[model samples]
Target: MATTASTAAVTSLASVTLEVADLPSARRFYRAFGVDTYVGLRASEAPSTGFRGFTLALTVSRPSIVDGFLGAAVDAGATVLKPAAKSFWGYSGVVQAPDGTIWKIATSEKKDTGPDTREIDEVVLLVGVEDVKATKEFYVGRGLTVAKSFGGKYAEFAAGQSSPVKLALYKRRALAKDLGVPVDGTGSHRVVLGGTAEAFTDPDGFAWQPAA
Candidate 1:
């Protein structure tokens, strides 16, 4: 949601393909979120449950804009997982989209000084994996560089030479807790990431197909 708006133009994520049951409904929901672009939609009824092992983040510029995007999601039939609130890091809110993707709208800026704008600074796709260091190594072997990291707690990869949507890794339980969801998931991740050097599955079974 939030336009799939991404400033995460640094590794892969050439295309964020979401496999949804209802294309028309999904399209409308995303459109109402003010996003007419990004994220490919395919028809699928894959049985996925619980947390889905990942979350999409819309990083905006201010708290007000964060509120705007979060509100848009609520209006679009998304369930609020966490209400918008200021925190030590910044301000943010979490919502599970109608299609079951957990999205976080946030900003490093804790306060609003001017009128809100629908500008997303970064669209981060955080994968909740079982192991951060190992997965980080897996991605590095696949030609991604580390953008930022903190021991084994978390790690982010540089955006591909020509792509949007930065990729990051975090402990699965930690991510689920952060998103206010349970720490168990089964079946397809319901997502096929584009823009990989080659098609392969990760250590955690997340699929990566070549970007077309």
Candidate 2:
């Protein structure tokens, strides 16, 4: 986060707005993707290439739910960046939207406790930052409280009950690697974060606006 020191405004991440080229197509895609209600959309021709320096992740209770989300995304015209698979952490998959936004569906649980259901545990917005320590300091300097910190590698902020989206930071290259994308990217990030603040732009050029 950057600019004026408005603690309350920048503290909790309230919403996410994705700038897309075609509103109709994007809406249709997200509607099929089962996350349209979680995000706001606007039409913009921002010329972004390669990785966008951020990812919106869906955390679920089991691997089957992860498979369900990823599978739906694929059936809805999303490109598979990484197939659903288990890793050291758990099961997950990566997909690219038709409008070029990247999404991750994952779970820390290895197996399902019961039948698979479309239950999303949480939605996290992870921004790829240049320095996790510095950014952590920046957010902490505001009203944001740190929920978890891992050296200079990553940081997650505690979100209020009113906040629908959680904010987190990770190293740029490492985030790209985790998202299965190249580390090279240029131009607008094409995504805006909405919070209590009227408007602000982060150090990496991620914009923030007031939640509608």
Candidate 3:
């Protein structure tokens, strides 16, 4: 995506993953925002990759690890969809969380390369919501710069302006229609960056900056 002229060069971000209850919900959510989708998992049963030039893993079943964490998270206000357990791959597993609209928790797959190392690229998400004006004001009030108001229907903002994070907004229904979906937001979803601190809300849902 082409960034604003004043914005500095942003480091590339890798793929963004959503742990959803149903694949259909994911399709509706992203389709609304005009995000390109592709078949992720390979014929060999590996994770999905290559969407819009980024490697994407649609869903990963890691029961062994998820089960232990689900117990702790539920006690802290998380709505559990499925309890974690061992998966087919034999690793710790989990694949359910429906109520927590914001799921910024990091998965086990990503590694922390530290601030000095350049391992991950940046991520920019296009959010679809019910209201455009309200969404724009909400994010701007939270310290995000409105880089450009795309004809008053969509807006793009730097994730942190300096940190390699980015966020984009759009009307949910319109966005869904553009992406070939009727509507969206039927399941859990989140956009996470490896290392940045930012948060904001669009018309339909909330978005967090770099993962904590």
In order of appearance, the predictions have TM-scores of 0.92, 0.94, 0.39
Better of 1 and 3 by lDDT: 1
User: Candidate 2's residue-wise lDDT over 57-139, tens digit each?
Assistant: 99999998998899889998999999999899998999999988899999998877876698888999999999899888877
Identify the runs in model 2 with alpha carbons over 4 angstroms from their true place.
1-9
Give the per-residue lDDT of model 3 (tens digit) for 81-112.
Answer: 33333334332222222312322112343322
Cα-based lDDT for every prediction: 0.83, 0.87, 0.39
Highest lDDT model number: 2
Q: Which numbered prediction scores highest in TM-score against the true structure?
A: 2
Model 2, global lDDT:
0.87
Candidate 3 residue spans exceeding 4 A from truth = 1-17, 20-123, 161-165, 190-203, 207-210
lDDT of 1 by residue, 1-212 (tens): 01122322214557788889899999998887765475778899999988799998889889989888888889999899999998999999999889998899988888798767888788888999998998887776666789899999999887765566788999999999999999988988999888645566788888888887
Which residue pairs in candidate 1 have backbone atoms (N, alpha carbon, C) closer than 3 angstroms, thus clashing? Answer: 3-35, 10-159, 10-160, 11-159, 11-160
- Clash counts per candidate, in order, are 5, 1, 22
Candidate 1 Cα outliers beyond 4 Å, as residue runs? 1-11
